[model samples]
Target: MKILNPFRLGLLGGLGVLVAVGIGQTVISLATILTYVGAALFLALGLDPVVTWLETKKFPRWTAILTVLAGVLGVFTGLIFAIVPVIAEQVRNAVQATPRLVTAFFDGTVRENVETALPWLGVQDLLDGFNEWAADLDVTTIGGGVFAVGIGIATGITGAIIVLILTIYFVSSLNGIKSGIYQLVPATKRAKFIDLAEQVSAAVGRYVIGQGSLALVNGVLSFIVLTLIFPAFGLPVKYSALLAFIAFMGSLIPLVGTLSGSIVITLLVLLFNGSPSVIAVGIYYLVYMQLEAYVLNPRIMNKAVKIPGALVVIAALAGGTLLGILGALIAIPVAAAILIVVQQVIIPRQADL
Candidate 1:
């Protein structure tokens, strides 16, 4: 090689670093948009299997898309009507109950029970500390915090609408999108690339459907048990609708979702309805977890994703650490896609070498 000019090499390296930094800044600026697009794409993939199934039943692609969209809208509309009012009413009740709850806590009976349970703990001291802290809070700071929360809620709602619109577009044009992407591959490798890509997409679709089914099952069971069965058995479960909604949302993540939701619901039940309800809720969740693992998961997810248990845990933890809920939600399918590529391409290439 010709001897490199030191100044030129250093200048080029600096230029490269500047270009990289510019690109990173651009990426940081576009993070919110990218997140919206990713979430939309994910939802579209999840809905694809349903659209495909409708097509198999002799529905035209457009008709299938409409059918699926209508069903989704109808479900959401129904939920808004059915669930929102109950949740709102319960929330209002909770707000109204706050004063009474505080009064009861300060009353001798509740404090005595707590002090009796933990002899070393000082209930009065804890209350005094809490009161002092509350008294010391700045009104301006509190107002600012409330304003921030309002802004966050508004942003979340707007983002949700954007994601929904993008999801509909993606689902309608998914086939076209895939065809366009396939056109980019070199002619010689295009066929194989298409096959692999289709496999990965199908796997992702299946996973989303399976996970949603599990969440639906959990939500329905939770609502039924807490709202009806518990009350029938004289084990009151306050805010059952809200609790069930939480369960449904939490179960969207793999592996850890159900356990986490169960813990939260159990604790809330204990707080609201005392030890008897907690015991019932605890036992129910323990049995439910077993059934979910052995029966529901096998039937629902057997064909969707088959990653090793250890890898599943590892992927979920790593993804959760990196990107919170969304990362955890997508990690398993990403891992599955990697596995497919390794099995199909890397292993074969290695063997040939």
Candidate 2:
């Protein structure tokens, strides 16, 4: 036994290392799966309000769930069918136009306009450096980037399908899932947990609905402005649809989404149209951003979840810093949920004790 003890210990140590390596590999493999599941869970929470509304109307739970699921799937399927081809065509147009756009950007007309618009800001030197750098490169250099973009598109489509399926399953079983989770808590705490959970789910669902509505409005407004200006800019109106879609998708991300989307769309316009078009875009978004903040957001999001202005900014910054875009997207709702729990559950419990 004494002689065998060291050998046994070494064997166990080797086995422990193998187990650790296996666990790491398994986690890496499941990273994508976890991401899909998390996204699906968020969607399910967001859809809970629709199901609850249907239930209030005397519809059975399964009936409500199925109806909402079908409607969502139909809308998404229709959009995918309608947009995929158009986006592919736009990508081709963008690729063909890049070199030309770069050439246009360094022209005298654009330089004069930029200098005139911002008298203190010298733009010619910047343009000259960019032109020099660009002249040393060619369109073929973008091939690898385009190929990566293609791969991203393919992966995104697959991920969307998986998330959709997972979302349906999660929503259908939401009550069961909640009940199962509640069972893990002590009986005394179960009621409070259930109430808090319901509030969180409903808030999240309303936030989703409100955000979607805001995105639609933003997209429509962007499309109208871009289209009206396109004629004067000597560009076709057809490209407006692509730009609108980009705005719509981008605006789904919270806080900074509008700015990011606007910047992107504006740059593309500048590339195709000119400095004048970029100025128009800048002016439109400036006024529109004010309108969105003071008018649209207050009316729409007021009913959804009301976190203080300061908290919203802090949460968004922290989320963005920690987890990039997804974190930012969910931060406001999460903050509201936490606030609700603190006010309703935590405070009351503390007071009672």
Candidate 3:
């Protein structure tokens, strides 16, 4: 065999490494944009089933898209209106309650109770230290913190708007996007690729729909129990809407979400509403979890890809480690897509070999 030229090999290897580094840097710089695009695409896929269903019912494609978007916007707007005033009122109440709480800690029955419960601990000294720390907080530091919070809020709002616009565009043109992507494959493999792609898409869409239904059921039931039933039974549940919102969001995640939300809500009830309310909430959630696992999940997710439980856990953990909540949310579907490819493409080819 002819000897390779060491210098030429080294030069080529170095160039390849440099090119990879450049691409990596570019990706890092564009991470936020990429995240927004990915989120929009995910949301679009989730909404696709509804649009298609509407189309099948004789709705014009554009009209169906518009209707879906309108409904989503309406729901979002209604939530904002419902939530904001409550949040603002809570903030105002908190600010007004702070001085009273401080007074109670130092001079009221709260101090006595704490002293009685923890005779060994220096509650006064602890309070003094906390006060000293608070006193040491400078105006500039507080202002900076406030400014940072404002900046974060603004950035979040901007990102939401960008994602919404991108989602609308993606939803409107998803079919075209799929057709364009199919063209990139070799003609010989294009049909198979399209078939696999459609299956993957359908799996993702069904998963989204199933998960959303579960979340919605959790949210609605939570709201009814907290906002209506509890009060009727003389158990006051403060921030019912907010608590329900938390339940809704948590249930959107796969395996662990509902349990996590229930635990959080139970803890909150225990802290704020005492033993009786906590007991009620805890019992309700425990029963709900059983129903969900036995009845809701199996029925709702029947049409979606049936990922192994262990695989789902592993996939969720890996995805969450890589990309946080969004990663966790999409991980199962991604795993399913890979499973499909292996089953349909790889195994058969391997068998032939």
Which one is best on lDDT? Answer: 1
Query: How many pairs in model 2 have backbone atoms within 3 A of each other, for residues 3 or more apart or on separate chains, i.e. clashes?
Result: 0
* Model 3 lDDT tens row, 1-353: 66479898889999999999999999999999998999898888889999999999999999999999998888778777887677567657656766866676566455554555446768778778988998899999999999999999999999989998899899989999999999999999999999999889888988888989999999999999999998899988766776887899899988889999999988666544555676788899999999999999988886676878788889999988898888988998899999999999999999999
Tens-place lDDT per residue, model 2, 1-353, is: 46668888999999999999999999889988987887788888989889989999999988999999999988888787887677778778887877865565655655665665556776867877876887798677778888999899899989989999999999999989998999999999888788888889899889989998999999888877777765666644446778889999988988889888988887676556555566777788888888998999999989998889899899989888866776787888899999998999789989999
* Model 1 clash tally, residue pairs: 0
lDDT of each: 0.88, 0.83, 0.86
TM-score per prediction, in order, is 0.91, 0.83, 0.85
Reference-based lDDT, residue 75, model 1: 86
lDDT of 2: 0.83
Give the residue spans of candidate 3 off by over 4 A.
Answer: 1-5, 91-150
| Winner of 1 and 3 under lDDT | 1
Worst window of 10 by summed lDDT in candidate 3? 108-117
Between candidates 2 and 3, the one scoring higher on TM-score is 3
Model 2 regions lying over 4 Å from their true place: 1-29, 105-121, 131-146, 228-238
Q: Could you tell me the TM-score of candidate 2?
A: 0.83
Top-scoring candidate (TM-score): 1
